[model samples]
Target chain A: MKIIVCVKRVVDTETRVKVAADGRSIDLGGVQFIMAPYDEMAVEKAIQLRDAAGTGSVTVVTVGPAAATKELRTALAMGADDAVHAVVEARMGPNATAEALKQVIDGREYDLILCGKQATDEDDAAVGPLLAAALGLPCVAFVHGLTVDGRTAIAEREVDGETERLDVDLPAVITAQKGLAEARYPGLKGIMAAKKKPLETVACDATGGKTELRSLELPPARAAMVKIEPTAAGMQSLLTALRNDKKVL
Target chain B: MAKYEAPDFFDLDSLLTEEERMVRDAVRDWVSDRFMPVVEKAYSEGYFPKDLIPELAELGVLGGNLDYADFPRLGPVAYGLVMQELERGDSGLRSFVSVQGALVMFPIWRYGSDEQKARWLPALHSGEAVGCFGLTEPDHGSDPGGMETKAVRDGDGFVLNGAKMWITNGNMAQVAVVWAKLDGVIHGFVVPTDAPGFTVREQRGKHSLRASVTSELIFQDVRLPASAILPGAKGLGGPLSCLNQARYGIAWGVVGAAMAVYDEVRQYGLTRIQFGKPIASFQLYQAKLVESLTEITKAQLMNLRMGRLKEAGGVTPYHVSMAKRNACHHALEIARTGRDMLGANGVAGEYQTMRHMCNLESVKTYEGTHDIHTLILGRQITGLDAFGAA
Candidate 1:
């Protein structure tokens, strides 16, 4: 089955960022970009399925400015069969990004569409279901266990703290989580081979959306952390502090 | 054959964290199922298992040591474990990957020109291009400064002449990184194995390291263009650094051999009945088995710390020298002791101790001789230049 996994180019999780002058925009200057952590897990899961089956092709799709190609190449390096980069000439958020990806994936039929439940930085988990609704396909939201047989995908997703099993139809959309699979590192050979693999970029028409903000803003700073001691009296003191000064009780 | 209990926490099947444990177990599985069965037949029969190299490459087991935190793996300790398992099957099998990953691919990744790195590393990493390091000459083994491999200035290129002794994988190597004394300076030459005037003859009738493809290399009037020279390398330090890098790997590798041998003895002592009871019931057998565990643990911890220190940018030649000496010394002793526990069968080809014992004799002697490391450590502990201008 042919599949397209949507990956986002984001700051590496290890990066510590200072908020930009504008509230909603992040200060990105000189920061290193990597495939989003959860997205890498999704990519690994897709590639693992494709490799294990030994018959299907996996195409990685990313939409952003010119710099988005780096994420596509990284996915290719991690063993994606090919890539389709929806080049956005203008700035785009999740809605536009999903729209652009849907447009690119529209002309071609995909067995399944995989994405992360949420981008770590943004915490928006709407993309998979959004794309599923747009494509008019069944949505497999927050899927943690996935396996393919013939054309159907057998998967389980957590609902109300209990896992609900489902046999999703082909051409469905699923968001992957950490439990899906441990990610694979790009070996030296794969990194070299990635350079030769096919990456096709097509111009994406802007199908804009309605969530407009007058200004970008940053959240308030996190409270400073204080060390806690482990002795009995120290532990009692810590409990009192948590109930009193910290107000965590 | 003795039953194996948990193999002293270095079995790798037990040593790594769960995720990393899976990776290590995968390596052993591949080694056992794919490489091990084919190795002895190839080595004793004097053939190189050229096909298996790519298999190793595919698993990223070849130079899989390059650090990346996102996909954490068993590092130097596991690397040592993998190499040891392969070498336990046969030194030739281990050397094929080692020479490619540790000796050749490592240098290209670290010191080659951009185009060279882009060109050679991927091919070697994938097992398409086989590489052999040419540093030891007929005259020089440990002290490569005494090397007489000559590279004379000729236009934009150089002509090389000199013979190399005991080159592992030399016959089957498609490309060789030959170290030569250029003018009065030392330089590394990436000579094609099929380069004009470069010839290799496999040394025959070997009692030790018989599983490996070892050869005496002759480079008579061999010419290489200036582009063939490693651009980022200079001086005797260039090749010595490579040897130091390789020796660190060997130090870790020998510990693995020692562990396997020790494990064999431990199992043999428990099963082989003598005096109408198991030999392991004897105080003497227990002593040998316990000693093997103790020393192997020390070496395992040492190599693990060495790997951490290396990743932290804290490695020195002295640390590796100390490790190499201790591990090789203990390995040789362990092999001999393990062989005794097996009695007549140890010397027989049915078991692995005597073969390991024989192969380790060569391993201990190469990279840096055990005695040479003793002096290198002596120089470190005491401010003495023993192997100095005399």
Candidate 2:
């Protein structure tokens, strides 16, 4: 089985985000970037399936500027066989990004494709479905568990507090969820070996996203927490406040 | 807590190779993710988290810079970066790797016979077997050439006798690279810890480097096969060479400790309120932060230069001693300053400043004492040996 895992580079989840001066994007100064968390799960799952099959390759593809190669190197260090750098200089939306990935995967030989349910930065959650639609392949979203047997792939997802199992034929796309697979830390050996791995950079012309981002703003600041006493009179006062002042009783 | 941003006041990252930065980042992340959560508890409980051995081996840190099969032959700078990152988490963690890679595995690779290498290198690399360097005897630390550990030729084998003290990984080691005198000359011997007459005693009640294992090793007429001797090791230079390797690592390792403490205190000062504002706004605190950052930056440059010189093969033991001495002193002082900067919170277990301060005490004293390195450099500069007098 040949697999292609799509990844995105986004600001680390722990970063203290600041809106850029442009008012439509985030400030990148001093910001650290990581392969999107869920996308790590996708890369891990691809490596796992390839290993279990004992004979296959995992090709990680990403659409971003040259700096995104750091994330690509991270994926390769996590055991991807090779990587493809679809060099898209500008920041594009999900539709355009998906279109670039599709252009890259147009003639690739892959039995499966994997992507995170969404990139954490924008959280669009639209790339996987969009790519699958473009390729006319079956797409399963929010997959937590997956297994491949012969020509069939079984995926498990949580829907409405219920477990839903879907069976898809070969050559499908799956969006990885939290429980899909746990990413491994790139070992020193892997980091060194990744330098020697095959990474082909291709200039991509895919641009002009379907949607444009509007002015962004930070959320309103939260109020300081209020401490409540445990005494009976305090409890009565709290009830009064909740019912009268806060009106949440 | 604010995410740790390593002090790169000098932009040292620009001086490092891409691979060096990548390897350093990988180790840093592993320490942040797997080691940090358990470090405080491990230190308080006085145990070196043995569970991390497999992970360390899997990461290929054990004997990583060696020519052993499948091991990455990382350059001196890369290896030093690994030490720096590990020590940033805790000195004990870095000590574990330094002893394994530089002290124990290095000798076996550099001097042991083919059989010895085939037998122990892979096991040590995989961390299936633990090893310790046994040169600092109870009576001979700085002057290991005066060691009393002796080996007598006994019919196609040797009988070893003596005790080694302050042995890191001693109690847990399956093998020890023991330096002993034979025919009035020093030689390196690979002794199995499980051999009859060989004994290990744990040293308890350590206030410094509490997260690491320190023990005493005793060899009472321990019989060893003729093959146990490292074939290429003839004199004190063999063990001294190993010390040089570890000291080189130490020079880089303490910078990590310094960076960790500096980062912690800088973050603390920025948010810590005093006199109606962040203490960082005060001149006193700013001076402290600047002093610490300045020293750390100097140490980083020195370490990188030393590493490059080592890789170029022009580095002498004197250079190694100077780097080790200066870096250790600066880092220890930085840790103490950081601890003091934290004030009451410094002594609290939640913060890492005090832990680093305590661990650095051991780091400064080990390999070569700060004073010993001073004398070594002093002797080199003045062409006079002040180590002894008539």
Candidate 3:
């Protein structure tokens, strides 16, 4: 199987994100950026399938400024054969990201394409399905586990309290989840080798904004964690607040 | 439909420079992807993951923490944050690095001979070889000074005789930093565990720190060349310094463990039902969760400041004592509360809280007992001698 895993460089999950003063994007001031969490799972799943299947090239593609190369190289160091960094503006919306990734994967024959269900920073989660749509392939979301056999793919998904199983064709898109597999760490030799790996830089065909952000707005302030007694009285008091103050009880 | 929000709300912009943020985030991503998923499993199985050491080395987490580079951190906070996040998965795995980076690697870097360092550091840092610290003997828990372990200077080398207990990563170690009294002066040595007379007996049936391999090291007159003595190190201060580094990291580490247990319990409380409603509706559950968050917050703040102090070179044992003690205690409490809130299921190894709760029991005792920090603070406040506190 020829698999292409799409990853994104986003704000660190633990970072204290603030809205940009312009009210159209997250403030880069204090935010620490990192590889999106689910993308990592996607990368791991792709690698696992490649290894278990005993054949295939795992290519990681990321869309961002030059800094995105680091996460791309990291994927390379973790056993990916090569990488493509599609440079795009940081303020690019989900469509821009998907379009940029699209250009990178275009005309490249691939049997399977993998992606994180969503990026933690934008949390739009549209990039995977969008890329699949742009490429015109089958798509599955919130997949907890995945496997590939010949021209078919198998996936496990969580629903309500029970887990569901899914099947799709080889030329499909899968959004990875938590239990797929644990990602492996790169050894020092790999870390050293990643610096010298063949990372190809490509231009994105974003073709401008598919969706324009008029402005970026900061989320409303969270109410301080006030003590709420978990009792009838406390429940009633909360209910009263909804009924009397915030309305819609 | 729901939208996700970020967890960072700290007004710490003024506190950190841009470069520090880059280094911190890079390390965070590395650990989250590499360590988090398998950590709970490693901890529950009571096995130190041999594979991840090199991965950590590749991320530069082992000794890159204390060294200077393009990132001139104002505090050891970067290092602290790394440990904190590692422990968020499980403490035993973090302790493995603690034993190497802080315990074994630091000493060799600080005190090893040029030859010794050249021979050992690169491999240890690369995680090619597992390293551990053996300061606590069966009889030398808190009073390492009264250690019965002895090293007699032989013809061209020294012969070591002793048994060390509760050594983290011990049974699996390729190397160990050992302290033994020599000619009335306590000194440290870098002993290869596979040396002729050296034997590492894995401690069995442990209820705590099951993920980390605990062992009793029996050096039955282990003999090695004089080169084994760390040239720059002599006396208790050497081992103590290594312990301080580990403890500083531990102070940050336990907070992560505390956060995990608290998060689990809070989630459980919010969803679990009692009396025909969510038990989170109870004031008692709220109190438990609130107090947990309160402690976690305080510990986080303490560690953040402590990191800066460490980077600023103003960090002393007392500085580390404060954070380590608080974090250890809170982590233990949080784990216990987590188990309690979950009722019988908490005791099972399925959830991470029970394992961490059990592990913290050992973490609390090692590096320095919780009571040791109380008295270290006491000594700072009042000029009183308290060997009795030991």
Candidate 3, A84: how far from true, in Å? 14
Task: Provide interface RMSD per model, one decimal.
Answer: 11.7, 1.1, 8.3
Judging by lDDT against the true structure, name the best candidate: 2
Looking at model 2, residue B85 earns an lDDT score of 92
lDDT by residue (B12-63, candidate 3, tens digit) is 5346543444444455556556666676677666677778776677666676
In candidate 1 the C-alpha lDDT for residue A47 amounts to 93
Candidate 3 lands at a TM-score of: 0.67
Ranking by TM-score: 2, 3, 1
Clashing pairs in 1: A23-A216, A23-A217, A24-A216, A24-A217
lDDT of 1 by residue, B1-390 (tens): 322222545553344443333344445546656765675566456677777776777777666665322222335655665665565556656766778777786676667877777777767766687788888888888778888889998888999999998888888788888888877788888888999999998888777777777888899999888788898788988877877777777776777677668777777777888899998999988898888888888887887788768868898999989888898888889898999889888877667788778888888898889999989889889999899757
Superior candidate under TM-score, 1 versus 2: 2
Evaluate residue B13 in candidate 1 and report its C-alpha lDDT on the 0 to 100 scale: 38
Candidate 2 lDDT tens digits, A1-249: 899999999999989899999999889987888999999999999999999999999999999988899999999888999999998777799889988999999999999999999999999999999999999999999999999998889999999999999999989999999999999988888888899999999877677499989888999999898788899988998999899999997
DockQ of each: 0.03, 0.72, 0.07
Second chain TM-score, each model: 0.92, 0.99, 0.91
Off by over 4 Å in 2: A226-249, B388-390
Q: How many residue pairs clash in each candidate?
A: 4, 0, 12
| Higher-lDDT candidate of 1 and 3 | 3
Lowest-sum lDDT 10-residue window in model 1 chain A: A184-193
